[model samples]
Target: MFAGAVRVGTIDRVGIALSGLCVVHCLTSAIMLAVLASAGGILVDHRIHAIGLVLAIVLGMVALGRGIVEHGFMMPAAIGGLGLGVMAGALTLPHDSGEVVYTIVGVAILALGHDLNRRAVV
Candidate 1:
């Protein structure tokens, strides 16, 4: 997909633009999830955790909106919703299990986001 030139229409151009924003936040969430795991707990830095939590919420909402706008459904919301579940699970884990779970879920979010962005309509 990265090998060819991007021939973008106006709507596609807008989608392509938004693709970056949501995906970018997804990436940021991944990184923050990693660091938040180390220092024993994310509560240690509520600010960073707060940022990731907010980003995850935003990405989930945007993905949901895109699915509704583009396809009259909520597939993006579903995918991002899974990410939200994972993130919440990670945050709530009693111990370091959060790190392990977050990593696995983060990878899924990254892959799902990529697939959603890559697929041609229908």
Candidate 2:
């Protein structure tokens, strides 16, 4: 049981870190796009967003799913799901400011969910 908890904790930490990175990437990409119109686009490619979204979905599922099972709290999972949905929806929209806004909002909400999940475990 202790070992399982430790593993889950590690997963939660990684999910949290990844969520933070997603935020940083969104913000930095936006700023870069504004400053360096030509080169910045390269930095904020669709592939990068796709990769981040994939990681977020996978990690969010593992950590949040475990937390929900252990704590029996659905809020964390609900929030995380909503965040993931928003992030995924961003991909379907035009790759403009709207997409950036959605990504930022989604990542922030997802990170909050991860935080909640971590707390629930304790």
Candidate 3:
């Protein structure tokens, strides 16, 4: 039981870290694109965004699902699901301000869900 709890905690931490990275990536990419067009263009690759989205989805589902099962809390998982949906929707939109807005908002909400899950587990 203790070992499983530790594992879940680790997964939750990792999910939170990934969400943080997503936020940083979004903010930095936006700033860089606006400030240094050429350099920022190189930094903001579609592959990176896609990878981050995939990681966020996988990790969020795993960690949040575990939390819900263990704690019997639905809100965290629901919020995270909503956030994931928003982020996925962003992928289909134009790569302009709209996409950035959606990504940032989704990451924020997803991070909140992870935080809530951590608190509930504890």
lDDT against the true structure, per candidate, is: 0.50, 0.84, 0.83
**Which parts of model 2 are misplaced by more than 4 Å?**
1-8
Better candidate number, 1 or 3, judged by lDDT? 3
Model 3 TM-score (2 dp): 0.87
User: Which pairs, if any, clash in model 3?
Assistant: none
Best by TM-score: 2
Q: Rank the candidates by TM-score, best first.
A: 2, 3, 1
Counting clashing residue pairs in each candidate, in order, gives 0, 0, 0
Decide which is better by TM-score, 1 or 2.
Answer: 2
Order by lDDT, highest first: 2, 3, 1
RMSD of each: 8.1, 2.0, 2.1
In the range 1-122, model 2's lDDT, one tens digit per residue, is 33365665677778778878877877888898899989888977889878878988988888888887888899999999999999999999887789989988988888888888888875
What would the C-alpha RMSD of candidate 3 be, to one decimal place?
A: 2.1
lDDT of 1 by residue, 32-90 (tens): 65676563344434455446557656644554445455555556456656766776666
Compared with the true structure, the alpha-carbon lDDT of candidate 3 equals 0.83
> Model 2 misses residue 97 by how many Å?
1.5
